[model samples]
Structure formats: C-alpha cells, structure tokens
Target: MSRRTASRALIAVALSVSLAACGSDDGADSPDSSPSAAATEVTTDLSEKPEVPASDDPAPDELVIDDVVVGDGAEAVTGSTADVKYVGAFYESGEEFDSSWSGGADETIPVPLGAGRVIPGFEQGIEGMKVGGRRMITIPSDLGYGPEGSPPVIPGDATLVFVMDLVEVTP
Candidate 1:
C-alpha cells in the first residue's frame, strides 16, 4: 500500500478503538473506571460499636502483663514493614480482645505499618522500636479504638495496651 493510504488505515483503526472504549458499559474491569451503580455492598462480620470518651489514664484495675517492657527504636513510617508479635486488650477491663498469639500461635506476622491494617494507636506507638525488642504501648481510646470501637470484646473508649515484640526489620 502507498504511505498515505497506510497512514489513513492506521488512523481509522485508532479512531475505531477509541470510540469502542468510550462506548463500553463495563466499568468494573476498566483501570481508570469507577465501580458501577450496581456495585456490590461492602460488609464485614465484625462490627464496631460507637465509643465514649475514656479517661486519659490506664484504668486502675487493668491486668498487668509481666513479660512486656516498652521500648523506643525507629520512627515507623506508614509503609514501613516490621516483624512483630502483638497482643491487644481493652484498656478498661483489661480483656484480651485480639492477639497474634491467639490459639497458641507462635509465628509472628510481618505487619505493614499503616493506618488501615492496624489500630491507629498500635501503628503510631510501635514506631521507634529496634529489632529484638519490645514495647508496652498504652493507648488511650482516642488514639485507639476511637468512636467506632471494636465491640463486645473491645468495649468503646477502652484504652488499649499492646505488648509489641519487634523480632526483625524488613526495611
């Protein structure tokens, strides 16, 4: 084919592709597209309870964890990854809500230090700990579970105490 004819054919093909893309109704699989109006509902089994303002102090009757000793190490950034074994509890009644050691699990998970993956307090407190170290972070409700607290086991406005074991450094 002549150069002008070949160029025209290529241009026509490009225009066709553009038009087809613009006409597509499927937004789910499109990279730049948003979820369609028929988007599925987002739900979870565990629901958080509304929190109340808690005392700034760790409750007087809170149970004591003898083994954990708080420390200071690296200032953890949002995306920083750390090797940590953690046990969480309500700061009020001192109930064990969730833990990495639950069901006698010994393996430590690599926690991505960020906002969503972890409680805001745990994420903020664990920063600045060196490897082979531990920190007993006592987070007040505002810094912890917040207004929408993890309920039943973790009561609203409950202070949280975490014994964070920093096993290694992945950064």
Candidate 2:
C-alpha cells in the first residue's frame, strides 16, 4: 500500500484509540495524521532571526528558536518552502506517536508551509528559522487539540511536543 494510504489508516486507528478519552465525537475526527519526521524536519530556506537583544522579548507568548529548543513562543508562523523530517510525542505521557522518516534517514519533503497541511502549532512555530537549523517545538493544547484530543495515548485536551531537526531547505 502507498505510504499515504498507510498513514490514513494509521490516523483512523489512532482516532479509535484516542476515543477512550475524547469520546466518540462522531464526526469531528480530523484526517490530520500525527507528526511525521518530514513534518518537523521542514528543512526550509533558513533566514536566521537577528539576535533579539537580551531584553528583546517580543510578545511574551511568541516562541523563539535556540539550538532547536523553542522558548518564549510567539504565535505560530509559516515558512516559505521547507524540507524536513520529524518525531512526535504526546505531551502527557511523553510517548512517541509518529515520525516522518524513521531510522533517521536523509529524507526531505518539500511542501508549501501553511495551516491546512500541518497542525496549527507547526505551521506557526517554525517561522524565521534558517535552512540547516535544528529546533524543538512544544505546542500548547490550544494550538494542538483545542479541547477534545485524539484518545488513548493523547488524552483529552492534550498538548503535543516535537523534537525537530531542520535538515535542509530547498529554497
């Protein structure tokens, strides 16, 4: 079967598993798949942010990238073109849920970075990163699940986290 098909099937299974918590919301199940290595690995054209002055804390909520660790998260932002791979874990249990490229292969997926293709946290988080930079992004429940989470591993209103390594950028 095609990888995409397999992924869809996995999403369906994941939803069922999550049903234990989010309740059978019936038709609210989103076709959104868990983060793939590629999703986080968006090795996009790197445009390094100018050093924020030590006192430079824009919106206290805006997240900043430092050595791949996200801090002071700003509202989510989108990249222009990204090639990446990623690994996802549930915030509550810290259990790995998905990855774009398993075994850390040098695989890159080029995508038009935006909201629909990826989760809101992701589409908004990796903005202003350089092409070959690696960063870890922690997404809040609101940007992640809102209120009802996909059950089982991801509890209701669960937050999600991703350890991403922006491997390359297609420019």
Candidate 3:
C-alpha cells in the first residue's frame, strides 16, 4: 500500500481503538457534534494551495469547518465513500506532515464519511461537501488524536489542520 493509504489505515485503527475503549459506538459524545462560536471563526481560501495559520495550542472545544470551494456535484453523505486529495498539518506550526497531493493527482484516497473510521472532526467536516468541493478542517485534540496523539509526527493534545478536495462520492 502507499504511504497515504497506510496513514489512513492507521488513523482508522486508532480511532476505532479509541472509540472501543470508551464503549461508544455512535460517537454521540464527540466534541465535533456541536459547533462552537470559535469553530465558525475559521477562515479558508482555496484559490490556490491552502495555507494554514499557526497556533500554539488546540482549540479548547469544538471543531472548525471552513468551506473553500463549493462544487456543483453530488453531495457526500454518511455511509458513502469520498475520493479525496488532502494535506494534513499541525495547527500549531502549519507544518505539513502528510498529503495525498504529494503523490500526484492519481493519489486521491477513498475515505468513508461519518463511519467513525476517521477522526471526529474529519468525519463531520465532509458532511455536506460535494464532489469537486474543497474544505479546510481544523480539529481540536479532543476531536482528533486526543491526548495520546499519533506519536512522533503528531504531538500529544495537539491540534490538526487538513485541507481536502472532494473529487468524487460513491454511495
């Protein structure tokens, strides 16, 4: 498998483990369920390559979702899979850590939306995205990797930023 695929798998496993440990299968208690005022204050621009602003710490609560491009195509919904190109970075430094784009245009990944297979913020972020749409998602630690973090690359209690382009949706 490619690095991007591996990363996605790892994220899925991590999220699954976390959720199982908590004995919650529905993700109802997730922080991303309700958007806070701070979550709506995020700004995003997708005209060119995305640039995330640096922050020292994660948002106290809530996940931020900002739309960059609204595509005129089929919307991605729960239980559906979305083919996407994405770049991930640390919110504190805006330093890129992973990107499907790095592997070229053909590297788009198919990810399940709202299946608890990914981080809560990511699952919620793509809820209304259409094929060809683009978005920037800011995830607080609680809604991301949480206090344990993803190890060497992602720090404990760190915030994450992801810029995603929804290429297609398969229901």
Residue-pair clashes per prediction, in order, are 6, 27, 0
Model 1 ranges off by over 4 Å: 1-78, 103-105
- Sorted on TM-score, highest at the top, how do the candidates line up? 3, 1, 2
Whole-model lDDT values for every prediction: 0.54, 0.51, 0.74
25-52: candidate 3 lDDT, tens digit per residue: 5355322333334323334343345555
Better of 1 and 2 by lDDT: 1
For candidate 1, the per-residue lDDT at 76 reads 43
TM-score of 2: 0.50
lDDT of 2 by residue, 1-171 (tens): 999999999999999888876753424322122333323443333332211111212222322233443223222225456665666675445467776655445655554567357667765555544455555565777777557776655666655666554544443
**Model 2 worst lDDT run, 10 consecutive residues:** 49-58
Prediction 1 TM-score vs. true: 0.52
Report the C-alpha lDDT of model 1 over 16-133, residue by residue, as the tens digit: 9999877656343222223211111111111211121222453533222222332345634557788777666555444566677653435577778774676666666555556644
Worst 10 residues of 3 by lDDT: 30-39
> Runs in model 2 with CA error above 4 Å?
1-66, 69-79, 151-153
Clashing pairs in 1: 70-136, 73-128, 73-129, 74-128, 74-129, 91-159
Residue ranges of candidate 3 with Cα displaced over 4 Å? 1-49, 56-60
TM-score of each: 0.52, 0.50, 0.68
